[model samples]
Target: MMPLPGPSHQPPPLHSTAKRGRPPAPISPDAGPSHCAWLEPVRNALFTSGLTLDDLVVRSGYSKTRISQLLRGNDYYPSWEITFSVTRALGLPTRPLRRLWAAAAREADKADDWIKNCIDRVVHDGEEPPLPYQAFTDDVRGVYTDYARAFLLTDQRARWVVSQAFDILWVCWNTATASENLHRYAWRLLRSCVIARASRHQDGRPDLRAAVFSTRGIRDPDVPGHLVFFTELIDLLDAITRLPEDQMDVAVLQHLCGAPHHVIARILGLAPALTRAVDHHARAALEAILTTPTPE
Candidate 1:
């Protein structure tokens, strides 16, 4: 397998693509809903906190226009600095808010360093993230990242989604560890984070059409013959998306990533036999789909 790109991986600029003097374009249609979803909690917090706009301007140290735009989900996704400022002013926990902000930033296609640097500025009361959580991240971060990138189709997005998942895991570390299986709980969390951001077909199942088209790796291949394989790969990926959720997960982690069945079972917290069964069913389904004749 290819090496995962480091945090420095830079894709085309997201909201910052406009000429220097011109304001960046409005958030795309696809990103608007996600941006608003992340803001919902912040809006609720502001309402219940009984703080007025003027009060937030004073407490957050941002101009009223800036706070209003941030609250309204306008122009661009807000930076963590402003988000943390407003959330702190409202006396909310920073951990969960950071997770939401990270997700929104990824939707906006914000750079990895931009997210990290924004998060780094938040004062954690001199408290480090829990040591056990740190250890847990070290354990599954690799497979988790590859699993995500397989769906998201880019190193940058996969990294952001995984980063957000870890942020969420850190926030709920106690509950996660106390659950019946830590691996299962973390896996479910990670799965949800990726699926929530995945592009979708008209049927609302996860789709890779956008990722497959936009990815530069396929467009600029290192080998000539790889282009012929890419056509077949697209069909295979589409078929995988058509599987039931459990079967899809098993297929991707097992067949796509080359993870051993035992490792898959451990990560999914399924019995080894059941994991194999799901993979078996997934393969059978894919074969049926691929072998069926197309209409003339």
Candidate 2:
């Protein structure tokens, strides 16, 4: 039998183009709501706000599979895509994120509406909310500047990047968590690095690691094994050590390290076309660095 001609008056059924599948699963007890304690509330809040995982996937500009995984309660590191999408979708003001940042998940539930509560907190944060720790700035600065500098490197750019990185570390390590004592530490670290590198002509190369860490004061605590860059950064730094000096490319270094591209671009002031070239050379250098022999 022949199908009838397409509808003469009405549009064809949407099913003609729609995927064949059951409707998405609704929230179910069996789904056991993903535990990730920090993310659970955010997920619930999104669900109750006339949104769904599919909506999140579309709005967040993430792949459908990725959003599904996130809804399953896995840990999510906030990024530009998720941050911008959620904020825009919910129509959040500039400051709502701050309240969300500081409020405990349960407290978010206590409020009648998370959105209203966030707005109220934003309006009042200037008046009565406790300010973030002064040290928060230093701590954050320490982490971010290193990332910034690592991506802006050239021989000329090197010292400036080092300087910026040193600025944060110097303040964070040598001074009280409050006072920015970076001046002395910055100078000392840079000078020490220069001296160690310069003196390598004699002692077959100084122990740069020892030199870098030793200046942190007598009580200089060991850097946490997973800190700063976590595992990826540590591995990348190791890769840098083995790469040939001339082969290094800051752009490539960031990619292999999983550093954000926009951030690296902002740091280097280079156009977008350079990304692949930078990534390729940087990866090659990293591989070489991993295999380089240290002069004993």
Candidate 3:
């Protein structure tokens, strides 16, 4: 307290972390919800390409802090410019990641609308506005390809699962207030429904081999002479259905639905490390089961 600092010697402002060439620190993973599913793939691509966060910052012309936020899913929704830049920097295929980014952005915008509507209804004591069916349907349609692929692999149950998911959503809209993120909630509900249906079908199976082979129309006309391959595929699906619930769910999400581990973790309310371990165990079990010959 003996001497006061001069203007030139004053400490830097708290918000002035940005520098001409220096990048900021990355945010911790636990900082926020990991809703952006495409981020993990971008991180993996960076690792595979031997690139660093600084490299991404430089290439994308975004500050290190913003890049970190987007990559870590700390941002509620990433912008298209950020997505394009990061995708370009990582040399990843753009279309799928773009679709995920777009879906997330739409959800974020809709979340704001939902929150406002909720507040208005509460303050005015008016009848809650009906949920926007068109917007909801559009959001579902965005990810339907992946969702259908995941459930269809088992027994062509995609149509049924989609219908059931929408029905559940309608019920939820009538009963519950708006959620923090409606799209994520709806997607998780859909996945849970699919998993429950798959488990119900697999329960109490004594001889999986007999049951799998006895099922009709397991063959694909597109593959002219790969009967053995088709049979092996069916056996693999049966093995997947036999896995413990956590492992089975992780496997279906990762492989069939093409979800990243972080996305699976968020959807299942699990830690990322736990999700990765479950997927690893599931893969190992599948390998063991698939390699073993079926009883004659």
Candidate 2 global CA lDDT score: 0.38
Runs in model 2 lying further than 4 Å from the true structure: 1-144, 148-258, 292-296
lDDT per residue for candidate 2 within 32-105, as digits (tens), equals: 21122223333434543555556656555667666555445233333323433443443332233333332323
Count: clashes, candidate 1:
0
Best by TM-score: 1
lDDT (Cα atoms) of all candidates against the true structure: 0.72, 0.38, 0.54
Sorted by TM-score (best first), the order is: 1, 3, 2
190-272: candidate 1 lDDT, tens digit per residue: 99889987888888888854445543457678856677667777888898998988888888887566788888998888999
lDDT of 3 by residue, 1-296 (tens): 11222355332221112223322344345432223244544554454455577777766677878877776666445555565666655544444444444444554564656434333332212123244844665555535535554555433466655654554454344222245666556666666555444334534532224333323344345555467656766677678777886787677566556677876776666778988888888999999888888799
Q: Which stretches of candidate 3 lie over 4 Å from their true place?
A: 1-145, 148-160, 173-188, 195-225, 266-269, 291-296
Instruction: Mark the 10 consecutive residues where model 1 has the least summed lDDT.
Output: 10-19
TM-score of 3: 0.38
